[model samples]
Target: MAEGDGVVKSAGRVLGLLQVFAEHRRPMRVSEIAQAMGIPQSSTSMLLKTLTAMGYVSFDAEAKAFRPTLRVALLGAWLNEEFATEGSVDEMMVEMARATADAVILAVENGVWSEYIHVVQSEQDLRYALRPGTKRPLPATNLGRVLLAAKPDDEIERIVRRINAEAAAGDRRFDVATTLDAVHAIRRDGYSFAHNLISSGASVIALPMPVPPGYKPMAIGIGGPTDRLERGQEMILAEMRRLLSQYLGG
Candidate 1:
């Protein structure tokens, strides 16, 4: 390979490796990382060695696992400060988790998908298990619906059509009219909620977060078992609104 091509490949692998760490949110063995990245173990080992030497990753002798070090986190710390107050989104998600005892997710639109960028796991015994980096169809998920609500109807229709076009045969297609109706309802009600839409016996309540111009739109959501979320919907919405108003000034 050309020297420039090699450099780009290595850089992509480095970022991909970090993404794996972010998604799992735990120490990972070399084999696990290789399997997750679909790369060779030797290549993964070399990357880990380089990162360890750079003080960006550390190896645990006892557990035989590797984890990103504080240095990796510090790399993006200033970006958080520049955008939203550092830890403000995290604090808001944590507070919502505490108030509802359910999973709280921060999501943004990525193409035609709603990607969960961060998640606070539920504390309740019976709850849905969600992780950061999970993606849901923009028209099919409550979080996605709130995000779609932020867009114009014409744009939403285009996205729904694109999603349908890309869907495999036998997969459910998003009905443009129904999706538009849902988006209208979300715009009117100022939030989105659904039961047993994505997962059986699960429900989610989501609201769009205000973003500065040029920033990607985001949605915050609380999810849990249908019965529990239904029972606490009012309280959860109140707490969500309160925290959003407090931390995000919306």
Candidate 2:
């Protein structure tokens, strides 16, 4: 591999190792992490050592395992604090999560992708939930459409091309015409609703949020099982629209 490709691949491996630890939420032996993440034991050991030096991972000599340190949690603390300081979104997410009994998300555009910055999980046994920092292509998803609603048609199409190009890196392709049509509809309605777009058996309702200065465009979404979200679509959209209107002044 070329130098650049090697760097990127190494970075991905490091992230995947972190995910393994995060998912299990426990200290794990190097061999266990290597097996779970499909990484070579030698590479895993070196990466773990680097992370340990950075204070993002800790080693337990007696247990012969590794775990994420508190520094890992501290990484995003400042940004999360900013979100809470926004005043309404934190409190509003609580109410919305209760009202819909589904996952409530605060999402924003990051380059050609849409990312969930905060997620409030549903109380129900069956619900759709995504960890904060999860990212997806900026088309086809309700949250992505809502976040890009303010752009002109031409600009939206350009962004769609960029998003599709990015997805192409993973052998994924999106229909340009269909995606543009979705963007037009979202622009017309000032909101978006999609079924089985983000995930199988899941539906989402997303609307633009009133973002403060210096912040990127943002949206709020509610997601749940397809049937439940469909049945409560009217109520969910009404409540979210009302909340946005309060902050955005219609």
lDDT of each: 0.86, 0.78
> Which predicted model would earn the best TM-score?
1
Listed per model in order, the count of residue pairs whose N, CA or C atoms clash below 3 Å is: 0, 0
TM-score (all chains, Cα) for each model: 0.83, 0.66
Candidate 1 accuracy as TM-score: 0.83
Model 1 pairs in collision: none
Question: How would you encode candidate 2's per-residue C-alpha lDDT over 1-250 as one tens digit per residue?
Answer: 1124346877777777766765566899999998877768998899999999999999999999899998887776676454444434556787788877898988889887898877878879998968766888778689988877777878878887776666645556677788878878887777788789857899788888876568998988998899998888889988877665554443
Superposed Cα deviation of residue 199, candidate 2 (Å): 1.9
Error of 1 at 75 (Å): 1.5
RMSD of each predicted structure? 4.2, 5.4
Indicate the worst ten consecutive residues by lDDT in candidate 2.
Answer: 80-89
Local accuracy of candidate 1 as per-residue lDDT tens digits, 1-250? 1124346878778987987886677999999999988889999999999999999999999999999999998887765564454356766778889998999988998889999888888878898888666788899999999999988999999999999999999987999999999999998999998678988999899988867678788999899998988898899999998888777677
What's the TM for model 2? 0.66
